[model samples]
Target: MVLQDLGRRINAAVNDMTRSNNLDEKAFDDMIKEICAALLSADVNVRLVGTLRKSIKASVNFASLPAAVNKKRLIQKTVFDELVKLVDPHADSFRPKKGRSNVIMFVGLQGAGKTTTCTKLARHYQTRGFKTALVCADTFRAGAFDQLKQNATKAKIPYYGSLTQTDPAVVAAEGVAKFKKERFDIIIVDTSGRHRQEEELFTEMTQIQTAVTPDQTILVLDSTIGQSAEAQSSAFKATADFGAIIITKTDGHAAGGGAISAVAATNTPIIFLGTGEHMMDLERFEPRAFVQKLLGMGDVAGLVEHVQAITKDSAGAKETYKHIAEGIYTLRDFRENITSIMKMGPLSKLSGMIPGLSNMTQGLDDEDGSLKLRRMIYIFDSMTAAELDGDGKNFVEQPSRMVRIAHGSGTTVREVEDVLSQHRMMAGMAKRVGGQKKQMQRAQNMMKGGNKDQMAAMQKRMASMGGAGGMGGMGGMPGMPDMAKMMQMMGGGQGGGGMPNLGGMDLQSMMSQMSGLMGGMGGGGGGGGGGRGRGGR
Candidate 1:
């Protein structure tokens, strides 16, 4: 089973045991058995799975539990904690300080996506305000330099590689020295990989390591290797002594669990997970966040980080916040939000970071979701200035305007209508909650202050708004079955809410609104083969 399926299976087992009338030791044992089976089927090591089984059973001692204790909550928390232990190496990875050179070297077997991951990691740091560059030292493979050059160029990262230098160690030293002289914060050297752990490969790896003396060495392990990851990681550890691992191709493999668990067993920290081929798909791996997102509980912290990263300087978002505070949500505001969401990353990946939207976007892939979003943009682009600036009432008063937009945007009138309907829903929501400007400002101030208690209070306030006008009306929107319930699940109702209150709205609310809007525009449908309509522009 794939990681998603594995999570679902384990979640189902826990839910089954908790919901059982007998909730006795027998049910608890059965749940443990099912969870172990799921992990084993996902290619987790037998010994590790056995240990996890015992850990869960020990943690949730049904026979010794007090009668007043919440058995169901205890069992669920134990399962989550044990699963987290399976992936948490409990070792801190090397953190690069700003204003200095932190050389990072990549090592792995051939076809483990070492080169691509190099570019991805470089871009990740670059986007985070680090002066990052790439050094391609893989002289063994043909066109390796060209591949690195292409990826680096696309990501706009400075790269150094040689067309004539055949010695990988010489190339690595030259590149690292050049970048260090220029004071690059993070310099990633991509080395060549072999078909197997041969002596020649080991010699070359050690030579390159000695040359650059990278502060951190990362082994880019292929997740499809399954339980063999243990042996591969051990072999690489013996030779290159990599401090961290980056598991690639996890988005397509079922054995990701095995690879993660195996790597953790070796005590090597997993820094990031390559969730997809996109440059933005490199997710910073945190054990608890990973496990939470895996089990469909949502990664609210990750979602907040993504939102903050993408919208930190967004004047459009600021303007929209102001408009919402004044009870206004124009088509232009919606367009800006759609643009921001596009930049945040793939819709499917973002959906998983949300608690309830993942189930709504179940069958939708990145390509299809992106196409739907692009079409929405196309519709906005084809609109008149007045239509976009004002509320969507003009389209309703003049039905012919919808037809005109449909023809201009290369979409159907129904799609245009759906977009207007979504706008109306959001406009209504803004109108209803416009009176909470003081509360919203207080929440925003608390967020900026970064005080734990103040943030918690803000979360409690947002959670309290779940049943109120804040999110109650959103349930009628498409793809949003129950906004209040979803918010509650996100800990909004609980004192330990995870959702971040940005401006006046939370990330979950924004994403759910986007999902609902996209769903109305047929987001779940297949992609259009031809180019999007730009005719009337």
Candidate 2:
């Protein structure tokens, strides 16, 4: 959505040039000039745009490319690649050093969502099995500690804070020591947001960093800043490691050219993007896919990975496979699959991640897609266990079931029917792919390859080919039980996904059921919240 304007401009230029048979050198030059102007208007650096235009010229020059190829398509690909290269060049590739706690201190101006970002980062690592803790060193901001504490409570991670104290340095040092004492895998130090030129505030931040010795120091910048990003980045980099950048508000319609192109000016790698305000809205920056989106192409690999990450615990997945092998697939597993998918974000957002969806999303906007997905989900939620597990013929035998679901979810019967159709299609596809190792391998390869074009084609074909019965297909496999119920059980509960629970129930029940589970859920158990529970790429 951020690139809609730029995409229109680029598309117009290409169309104007290739729509006619007249191939004069002057016409090509005019089109390239239009593109260059559009990029510059979008706050992209003149030099970078010039470089891209030159590349496009070289690629399309009569001397280089084959004459048979469509000039517009060639230009599109060339421009797309150049855009991808620009964003991908300086992206952060650094990982936490082996066997060491990667101390990352978040620094930003006030109202930049610094505290929220810290918890999201912690949650991200926590899911990867990292023993993560939080250091609330923002003594300057009133209630900063409490705001972070609430999120920490939700995540069930730990937080080190002193309401009565104002010395952020002491807080940082104590937090680091507490984390080390308990052997936390990662510790994230959150700092007070300050004005860019506040020397005294920066001095405190410097001292805090010296005390904790963080492995990574990230600066969170609001994407709304546009071209002014350079000055802000410079001011922050002057006082700290400024290891990576986290650009927030990217899901909006802002040009964001300033945010992305700032990489060219500052050479700071963007590590993550804040797509929304929620904890799970933070996503790792995938340079290539981002550039593709900017150039109006789809990003399939990123979409698939999003699905995999969010649905890894879905019913009939790895654990289900294990259970099925052991003969444990049950009704509970089906519910888990449904709940987990809901938490993973909207189905429309998930759909956008599929490659080659460029045309599929042609006339639609984010809000439109999201609304459709919500309606579809509503339909699914209204169905009973019997209906969920029943065959398509069962739904056909009783069309009133659709009317009931439609009324329950405040949707149309047609919408309910559409959901049922999708479920039936998916169930059929799963049956077809059952035990087909090669087909699975091919899909996996497409996902891993990270090529948007090829991946889109694969996704389209797979969608058409279909799968069956939600996650229940696992029930027919050898030794598998109901995976959906297990996922539902895992997904249910209070306080979200970061903490450990006992009583063998949802997150809330576990917290209420066992004190030890509570200890492990917060920072007190391992590294005072910044503990390293697990580590990986």
Candidate 3:
């Protein structure tokens, strides 16, 4: 939260300060000081803050710029650059090697969310259709095996560990052998959390590493420990090779800034973040989005991924995006939007990805929020195919249709009406923006400008989901607009298209219309909502 707050203040300062023609060295210095103070107060490393301030001052010089240039944008870009550098100097992209299981070993102290984090990593791979197995190598902690086993069961991933296993290195070796026997794509070894005084356990970890020869050795740290992270990281670095770090409890006021900012100081890539207790709460680390969120600008990567995932392969997905960018989105596109969103998990869940949205979604109860989203999707789904693909006028003209849909979807007619109203608003917005390609280009350009070389290097990574195109393609998805669109649609988003007027259309009529659309487009396909549509096929 402090990071978000600091980002907001810095954005405001740059914007407000740039309006003045009489820019002075003192002004720049003052702004840098404010930034340094904010970061330091947020528990960022003091030395890192000093270096960042220096880098920012050198990169942005308002006085030397032409009067036509916007000082605010310059400062914002500079700040973005500085933050990116601080978070990811090397910008290492994870690539599991070919022809062998990439052994990933997790190490950390107790209460660092290590067990949950490992499950999240396993889930990430499992969702992508990888053959992944979880290994509970933490024999030192009681119930640790149970906790990890529960997570593994939930993810449906194969796991190996003994409740009474005394030797951690042997347990780890057996776990690796089990996964290897099963020909799993990857094997993740979850080691015990040893206290500083647990010299024997720490020594065992090195042996575990030697036995496993892990491709990635990640040190999990509780973000709530700010300055202590440095010392802990140093100690762990001395014992085992830590390829990256997973900072847990980042969703709270955990001073993750220090842990993240000090990663460079510890010489490790901050690979992933453990934001919550759930198995699905881990988010792959993206430097640009982290910087943007730190500066209150919001996450461009998350937005893009969400949209791409939601719009995948639907009839109106890409076109609607194109229309959205061109400002021509219509009511029909709005209805499809609801359906698209249903394909995703929940609105509240996705909403958390945006900066400063945690507070806004605080009142959203899990049951009620999920119920609302489900009801809305069902209401739309129960309508005739034509109604979904067309406007209201093409559907039934009677009020009884709405009543039927409500009953069918198990929701009140008002909820269905609300869904309809939301569609209308979205349609209008899309109609206003005739094309999405330009907007996408602008977004890509902004990202490239902010994180160009780093992203380029990342793009070279092999595909993760499958050959040719997958999660491994240059981070997330590959290619522009289309790949981005697939990521969004799968991630979730509203689609494009002008539905026929639904103003007074009856529910039966709408359902019939929707039916026709589904049938016409090879309806009843059980494939997940996120895939290639448009020219993608």
Candidate 4:
């Protein structure tokens, strides 16, 4: 995520300039140099970096700007625009239309993760209601077919391949024809790739492409190749008609800017980025939003879209929202929440979509952290109906309750306590969020092609959620602050409105303090709270 780090640095540099009384060419040049260094370090092509620097300098005419104009804002805007232009080719690429046979052929080097990407692509389409199937024409790699079959089976996607077939063209043709005969609308053919761009591999790829006449040929590029990505993409483009690029292993520590800019150099559009190893890790590339997320500006639109992809019916969504809005979430409700979030994909990814949480979650690259949520589900499921559904005070006030629940759930007492602690914190915040539902509703209504007022309302509501400070949309979120009357309501700052500093509490410590919950959970009587957002609807 070096490119992401670059966005953060660029944002910070711009802010530094704004803080100073003197805004001159010297300051501007310094920022540009920093950007150049960052891009170059991220393996961006030197020529492209030079061009971007020139373009930014030409647009940001700080010397001639009117005194009344905001210097910092203009410069930031120019930087964002220039960076986007550098990466976006704006090339027209194929999109699968419903009710038709759309064939996609994947091409790449042997280790570029081509086969896995084919399954991922097939799963993406399959989830979208496409009649999708996978065809493995990769006969060069040992166990290529077996690898594809394993991935396809896990994703529950139908696949076609042959152990006996030596000719990739025949295998591809047979698979496509078989899926087509079954009236499958989306057929993805994964072709052979070599250790290098050798003639034999190119010949095999060309034969398969000619036989199938693919509707779109997607070239999967490994982002870790850094500076060489451009040359690699260019070389491949010369051999096959690549309609789009898919950058894989983007979740790694590789400098990815080179891969992105290099592919764009060939006028090829990057349609998706493989964020992780899972089938659902592939994300449709959105340049501006990607940059925004990288800069820690929350992509609420993207977040909403991810949620929608996994959520099934309206009732299931609404019921969860009800619990969140009421500040009365039970253990049962908590389990459902965890289940729903798991469906949205990786926790680190989901967390990064939130405003302030990105910086915090950027370090959580391990899959083990995500398992914590699953553990919460198991621990909570052990509780009795009275224990699960009740306000959390019983567990907090009665130590024996924790013991009994731990025994019932087959978990350690410490784990049970941790689950209760998280529950209490969630329940408390739900009340606060529930109160702001009206303001959030107003903002959403205004957000339909609306202006700053929508963002203003959202900012205000977000502050009230007990997040550390104001967001920069001005700065998690937790998904904001107007204090005066609300703070006074909780008995002179100690009221349920003014809950304890649950933010910094340790997992172990928070578990034992569950009685502090608002509404019915804690010793403090919980007040009423409610809301109606997209999830609420």
In order, candidate lDDTs are 0.79, 0.64, 0.64, 0.70
**Which tens-of-lDDT digit does each residue in 193-237 have in candidate 3?**
887668988889899998888888999988878777777788898
Worst 10 residues of 3 by lDDT: 499-508
Superposed Cα RMSD, model 1: 6.6
Give the alpha carbon lDDT tens digit for every residue of 1-537 in model 1.
138888889989998998898888999999999999999888889999999998998898767889999999999999999989899888889999999999999999899999999999998888778999999999999999999999999999999999998999999999999999999999999998864548988889999999998999999988888878788888888888889999888778465766876566679888888888888778888999989988999887777666655665577876776676677789998898788888877777787788777777777767877777777887888787888899888776888888777777777777878788877877777775565554445555665677988766656655566546555454222221233344334322332223223423546347656666555776323234333544353
Regarding lDDT, does 1 or 2 come out ahead?
A: 1
| Candidate 1 similarity to native, TM-score | 0.84
Superposed model 1: Cα runs more than 4 Å off: 310-328, 343-346, 365-368, 428-506, 514-519, 522-537
Candidate 2: Cα lDDT at 284 = 77
Tens-place lDDT digits, model 4, residues 1-537: 436767667777777776778888898898889888888888888999899999999998866888898888898889888877876888878999888899999998778899889988888777667889999888878899999999999988899999998998999999999999999999999988753449878877889999999999998988888777777788788888798999999877777887877556689988888888877788888777777777677565566445545553445555655655444566666666566666766655765566666665555543654445544555566566677678788877888877765555444566667667767777776666555444444544565555776566666566664465542232344332333223222211331122211121111122222122111222211111111111100
For residues 1-537, write the lDDT of model 2, one tens digit per residue: 455577678767877887868866677888889888877777776677878887878877866667687766776677767766767655454576435677878998888789999999898887766889999999998899999999999989998999987899999999989987888888999999988778899899899989888888888987767777777777887788687888887767777677766676667888888877778887777877776554445554454344445654444444533332232333223334344445656433443444444445455454544444444445556667666545556668978766676666666666556555444443443343333323444545665677778766755554444343333333332111222233323332333242211112222221121222112212211111121221111
Per-prediction TM-score to the true structure, in the order listed = 0.84, 0.72, 0.69, 0.75
**Worst lDDT window (10 residues) for model 2?**
528-537
Against the hidden true structure, what lDDT does model 1 obtain?
Answer: 0.79
Query: Per the 3 Å backbone cut-off, how many clashing residue pairs does candidate 2 have?
Result: 55
Best by lDDT: 1
Each model's number of backbone clashes?
1, 55, 65, 11
**Candidate 2 residue-wise lDDT at 122:** 93
Q: Sorted on lDDT, highest at the top, how do the candidates line up? A: 1, 4, 3, 2
For model 4, what is the alpha-carbon lDDT of residue 359? 65
